[model samples]
Each structure stands twice: as C-alpha cells, then as structure tokens.
Target: MTKPGRTLLKVQGLTKRFGGLVAVNNMTFDVHEHEVLGLIGPNGSGKTTTMNLISGAFPPSDGSITMNGQRLSGLAAHQIARRGVSRTFQLVRVLPGLSLVDNVVAGAAFGYRKRWGAEAEQFARGLLERIGLGDHMHLPVGSLTYIDQKRLELARALAGEPEVLLLDEWLAGLNPTELQEGIDLIAELRREGRTIILVEHVMDAIRSLCDRCVVMNSGAKIAEGTPRDVLSDPEVIRAYLGDE
Candidate 1:
C-alpha cells in the first residue's frame, strides 16, 4: 500500500489524437497514493481516451506519463499491467465462458507468475471473497447478473494488485441498490489503500466517493477541485448543462 505523501501517477501534457481529431488534449493531473480521484466530463470530452492513455492502451500523441516515478509514456498495455497498473472498462470485459472465479484467477495468475502456484490460487480466491463474489465463484460469468459481472471486472483488476487502478464509469447501468452497493465496494477498495482514478458521470457517486474531481470539456480539462467546489463552478455547471 502507498503512503499518503507518495504520488502514485502523474500526467503531464497528455494528448491523444486520431487523424484530425484530438480526443484528449494537453491534459495533466496527479493521483495521490491511496486516493480516489474522480474524472468527470461531458460525453465526448475524452474521459475514456484519457483512461486509455494512462493505462498504456495506446501511446500518447504527445506528453508524458509516470507512475511511482517510473516513466510510462511508451509502454504497451501488458507491460504497464505488469508494472502495477490495472483497469476496468465502462463495459464489463469478463470472459463469459469462464467461471467468475476463474476469470479473476487468470488475472491473478498473470500478475503473480513469480509466486508459488498455490499461493496464486490462494490470492485469487481471497480476492474474489474480498470483492463479494465468493458465493458465485463456480458460476460462469455468463450466468451472473450485470451487477455481478461488474463485480467480476473489479475483482480481475484487483487481482493484479495494481498500484494504480483506473475505473471507467463502473456505475453505469446499475440499478439504484446495485449502484449504492457498488459505491460501497469502491469505498472498501479505498480503505484497502488502493490508488484510483475514477471516471464517472454519476454526480451522486462523485460527491459521495471522490476526494477531489477533475472536470473536462471539449477534450480539455476545465476545472478541478473538491467535489462541492467543482460541481458549483459556473464553468462545470455550464459544461454539464446544469446536471442535464
């Protein structure tokens, strides 16, 4: 676990483009160790693109990324994963044919290739329990509810034992109760001292769960501060169309 004073990840002038369009433009930020930093923006504001850049899904068009003070600008996604960064997409990415526990085990196995075999299984099993999916361990991911699939995605990310976790709209499509439960699960992860960068449009979740928020518009950051302050900023309000 990272201590409070450490900077888990830092982004400087990060930008991404596809042909003529800039999806993320000259953005920068820092995620403190063990802190939940929320990333919010309008639908096309490049939030997911930003997540992709940070997690090494693609190299940036320009700029730098660092994690635990190690340069991460050009690494491949798997290499970044091996270096203690993991992520979950807004769309759950579980392997439907595999059991929920088996899916987590695959992640744990990759991250713990150097550990003893039994130890890896133990770690995977424990992670499933921790993420509240222990009872569904034997069930195929295809049979799980959407909420449970979400949980499995989280469990897979956690199984990697990442130093920084990028969560992309983990609450989307959840029912009210499931959303609250998922919020509580995120809080539980925070308590475990994991550093997180969360991209969520759900204002209630942002207010209740984020330590601070970064708001973007038109593929560029517009404001960042405490949730209350950011939410009330005239620019942020304008960007959100007054909570459209």
Candidate 2:
C-alpha cells in the first residue's frame, strides 16, 4: 500500500484520437497512492478513453503515462497488468460458460504478479468468498444475477493484486440498498489501501468515497477538486448537472 500524497501514477498531456474525432484531449493529472480519485464527465467527454489509456487498452495519440517512474504508454494490456495496473470494464466481462471460481482462476493464472497453482486456486477461492460469491463458486456464471456478475468482475480484477485499480462505473445499476452495499465494498477496498480511479455517475458514491475529483467535457478536463466544490462549480453545473 502506498502512502497518501506520493504520486503513484502520472499522466501528462494524454490524448487519444479515433479518425477525425478526438476522444481525449491533453489531460494531465497525478493519482496519489491510495487516493480514491473520481473521474466524472458528461457522456462522450472521454472518461472511458482516459481509462483505456491508463490501463494500456490503447496507446495514446499524444503524451505519456508513467507509473512509479516507468513509462507505460507503449506497453500492451497484459504487460501493464504485470506492472501492477488492473481495471474492470463498465460492461462486465465474465466468462458465462465457466464456473464462477474458474472464471477468476483463469485471470489469476495469467496475471504477471502471481503463479498459477493450488496456491493460486486457494487465493481465488478466498477472493470469491470475500466478494460474497463463494457459495456459487461451482455455478456457471451464465446463471448468475447481474449484480453477482459485477462482483465476479471485481474479484477477477482483485485476483491480480494490482497496485492501482480503475473502476469504470461499477455502480451503474443498483437499488438504494444495493448501492450502499457497493459503496461499502469500495470503502473496504480503500481500507486495503488500493489506489482507485473511479469513473462513475453516482454522486452519492462520489461524495462517500472520493478524496478528490476530476471532471471533463468535450474530451478535455474542465474542473477538478473535492466533490462538494466541483459539483457546485458554475462551469460543471452548466456542462454536466444543468441549471436546476
């Protein structure tokens, strides 16, 4: 676990382009060790593109990504994973045909951080238990509820034991009680001291979990600060919240 205030990940002049469209535009920021940094923006503001760049899903069109003094821009996703960066997709990516435990175990076996063996299986089982899916370990993921699929995604990400975890709208669909449960799970992840970059629309989760926030619009960052401050900013209100 990294201490607060030490820059663990550095993104400088990050930009991404798809043909004529600029998906992300010259955004720069530092994610401190163990900071729950919220990345919020209106739709098409480049939030997901930013996540992809940080996690090496795609190379940047311009600028750099560095984690603890190492350049990460040119690396492949698996290479980046070995470097201790991990993430969950906004659309859950679980293997529907596999048993739940096997789904996590497959990821665990391939991660750059750990060896695949009995020990790894045991670790995967432990993660399922912690994510509240141990009883369903033998069940095919196709039969699981959406919420449980989300939980399985999280557990797969955790199985890699990453230093930085990027969550893309992990709380998009849930009731009030379910939302709080999601919030509590995030709080617990924070307690474990993982550096988190949360790309989410849920304000209550933002206020509850984020130590700081970065807001974007038109593929470029427009405002950044604490949740209370950013949410109240006139520009943010106009760009995202609308006059109310």
How high is the CA lDDT of each candidate model? 0.86, 0.89
How much is the lDDT of residue 60 in candidate 2? 98
- Residue 228 displacement in candidate 2 (angstroms): 1.3
Instruction: Report model 2's TM-score to 2 decimal places.
Output: 0.96
Cα lDDT tens digits, model 1, 39-116, are 998899999999999888889999999987889989988888888888999788998877676677777766524333
Error of 2 at 199 (Å): 0.3
Worst 10 residues of 1 by lDDT: 109-118
- Top model by TM-score, which number? 2
For candidate 2, which ten residues in a row score worst on lDDT?
A: 106-115
TM-score per candidate, in order? 0.94, 0.96
Q: RMSD in angstroms, all models?
A: 2.2, 1.7
Per-residue alpha-carbon lDDT of candidate 2 for residues 38-96, written as tens digits (9 for 90 to 100):
99989989999999999989999999999999999989999999888888998999988
Checking candidate 1 for backbone clashes, the offending pairs are none
lDDT of 2 at 49: 93
